[model samples]
Target: MELSNLTGFLVHRTDVKMTNFFTKILKQYEVTPEQWGILLVLDTERATSQKELAEAIDRDQTTVVRMIYSLEKKEIVRRIQNEADKRSHNLFLSDKGMSLKTKLMPIVKAAHDHVTKYLSDDEIQQLHEILSKLYATVKDE
Candidate 1:
């Protein structure tokens, strides 16, 4: 079969394209997609443990740690020792991060809107379901 006809190739290309789009959108703010994810998840979850942030962002702990370090350097996130578990830290958006998040969120929304604007609501829903099922099928391994 032609490479273009392969499911993996198509999915990979789509992911790359989306990543590139977001990279361009976020370049001025100096945030990677993974970092943006950490910020968003922390803000949404509110004072989340690193483990929780890792899972919510679909990233492994090691990668999350690295991303968190970058975020910490930028003063985008702060890590606090979990009161109950002194070993693990809870992550929160720093004041600078919150200000940046406030500014970046609408741009993020607009970027996503541009991505799905061509699809009908039903199509978009179907796409989400299909992607979720695909991830669920392979995520464990």
Candidate 2:
């Protein structure tokens, strides 16, 4: 088989293309893809701890801390002392972050829709399920 026809290579190419597309879009907001992932998780799960955010986003603790610091500096997120654990801090979206989410949600949804436009509803569901299973298997390994 030709190297160019390998499924893994093709998938990686597609991944890079998609990443570039999203990165371009996110650049307008001055955020990176990883930061966007963190914001998305935080939006969905409010008042999450740094450790929890790291796990939720499948990122290392140090990386999450750095992103959190950047977001804090931007005034988009705040780190409040965790009452239950004085050593830990809970993450919260600042008013600025909430406003950014509100402004960017439609753009995010549009990008999602555009990417999945070729798939039927059933196909989309199946794709999500299959990807979820694949993730679970890899995570368990």
Candidate 3:
């Protein structure tokens, strides 16, 4: 068992590489891959509470709060008080965020395509299925 052949090592290495690539592509927008993930989720789930956002993004609440604050400061996200919960806020993408998302969507797609350029569609699908299974197996452990 070489370190290079370890499942965790390989998956982590791939994640780091992909994160770096996404960070480079998003540098001009002043957005990190983590922030991009938040924005991506918000694009589909509007007025999501911070808790919901954290769950959706698979991040801890504290980290998600910090990311939300950064995005809010950039005018990319807006947090409105939750009517049902005084201590919680629902997050939404600002108009600027929506515009940014529109621009980023294609670029992100291109990035994905670039990364998987060598893989056939079936291979990509299989890869996703395998990854999802791995994720599920480790999620609670």
Highest TM-score model number: 3
Best of the two (2, 3) by lDDT: 3
lDDT of 1 by residue, 21-66 (tens): 9999999899988788877877624788888988898888998998
lDDT tens digits, residue span 8-114, model 2: 58757978989998898889898888888877877534689999999988988998999999999999888999999999999988888888888888998899899
Local accuracy of candidate 3 as per-residue lDDT tens digits, 3-26: 998999999999999999999999
Question: Scored by CA lDDT, what does every candidate get?
Answer: 0.89, 0.86, 0.91
Task: Estimate the Cα RMSD of every predicted model relative to the unseen true structure.
Answer: 1.5, 2.0, 1.4
The clash numbers for all candidates, in the given order, read: 0, 0, 0
Best by lDDT: 3
Give the winner by TM-score: 2 or 3: 3
Which regions of candidate 1 fall more than 4 Å away from where they truly are? Answer: none
What lDDT is obtained when candidate 3 is compared to the true structure?
0.91
Q: How far is candidate 2 from the true structure (C-alpha RMSD, Å)?
A: 2.0
Better of 1 and 3 by lDDT: 3
- Candidate 3 residue spans exceeding 4 A from truth: none
In model 2, what are the clashing residue pairs, if there are any?
A: none
lDDT for position 129 in model 2: 92
